[model samples]
Target: MEKFKNRWEITQNWQLIFPVIGVIALGYSSFKIANAIISKFGIATIVIVSILCFFLLLKFTLFLFKKLENKWILDQKWEMIRVFIVFAITGSSSMFIGRPIIKFVGITKENLNPIVYWFLFIIIGLIFYQILLVFFGWLFGQFQFFWNFEKKMLRRFGLGRFID
Candidate 1:
């Protein structure tokens, strides 16, 4: 318990538990996603491709973290990892929510031109992403940060007038 607390840089005893829970959840989700992809692509091909993709993704995430490190509210590096895990879950949730809506609306590639289908899909996904960003951020105790980010994203999309 002491080692876990020290490794996560959590000063409070209660705070130490959440990061462990977050990591376990993240690992489970990763495993499920990897298994799904591997089943689709076959074990040998997916194993090789997944390894390469994992390293590339790790590198890119680390680079992104380096750039945002100074600006991020969390002082500890491990906290950022927890935040990233939340962000990933939020993104996946958004996609999961968006896909069924898109299908229900008959916006699939079979029903529309491929480009139009994708465009609509992306637009809907972005809307869900904005909403989920705040919800998940609140769950992860970063609501203020994601709320500001959502506002900035809306402003960029020319929806600034709608934001209060």
Candidate 2:
């Protein structure tokens, strides 16, 4: 049988789907940890454990991505570079968000020690990175749609066609 061709075919790869699923799983685990900590230790504990869970979630995500890189399908080196870029963007952005959220939850300058503050920042950074991992994974999995959509938009804007 002959195969058909399309401009966005590369986006159909399963490499993307797996990562998105991983992200969701990590988020759920973090949520569960938060709930447990809150139940047993109160809101303060929730703040602390939420920070720890973020690190654990990011570690889990990185481990999974490492496994994917070892597999033969997607180019591991390229995938890792892209993942790191995404991690950097998301991690920084998350700190901006997480810091405020943490403060809102009562872990403020007055209440939290310097060590605890730094720990929260690190954990929140990881949490943000994991969130991006999942999101980019899904987006990569759906590349075909985005690719074609971009092409269509470009065409509408009088830009020339984009090749995959």
Candidate 3:
């Protein structure tokens, strides 16, 4: 508990790259699976797999929420967190995809007011960025706590911090 508190105090930012990498890898895997199944079957297969994956992900998400509640300081609602994740991914990806298309279509200050484009883009990007920062910070901190705790425990048992 003391170690967890100390680590949280020392590093409370987007410091851990592993969790985000893992999540992205999982998402890429899901996309590939969905595409392959869709190709083999049809749009129906894609929809079914997507829905199934969503539910499964939701279940895992809730489990993570519960684990965090038990082990960490944050007491965020699982439903709210889940909704935020969904909205962040959807909104960020849409803007990310749309920005290039808009630019490709020669959207300019004369065509569409620069202020309007900048306002929407900046607002959405900031919102998504803040949400991801909070989520990732909490997740990384939580895992870091357990990881350090395990190391300390093993050292206490004279395991020499490594297994042969």
lDDT of 2 by residue, 16-86 (tens): 54445545655666777798757777877776787789788788766766776655244333344344444
Error (Å) of candidate 3 at residue 94 is 30
lDDT (CA) for every model shown? 0.77, 0.57, 0.53
Q: What is the overall TM-score of model 1 with all chains considered together?
A: 0.73
lDDT of 3: 0.53
What ranges in model 3 sit over 4 Å off? 1-29, 33-39, 73-164
Ranking of models by lDDT: 1, 2, 3
Candidate 3, residue 49: lDDT? 87
* Weakest lDDT window of 10 consecutive positions for candidate 1: 22-31
Q: Give the local distance difference test score of model 1.
A: 0.77
Best by lDDT: 1
Q: Give RMSD to native, each candidate.
A: 3.7, 14.7, 16.3
The per-residue C-alpha lDDT of model 2 at residue 135 equals 63
TM-score of candidate 2 on Cα atoms, chains taken together: 0.35
Answer with 1 or 2, whichever has the higher TM-score: 1
Q: Given candidate 2, what's the lDDT at residue 51?
A: 71
Better of 1 and 3 by lDDT: 1
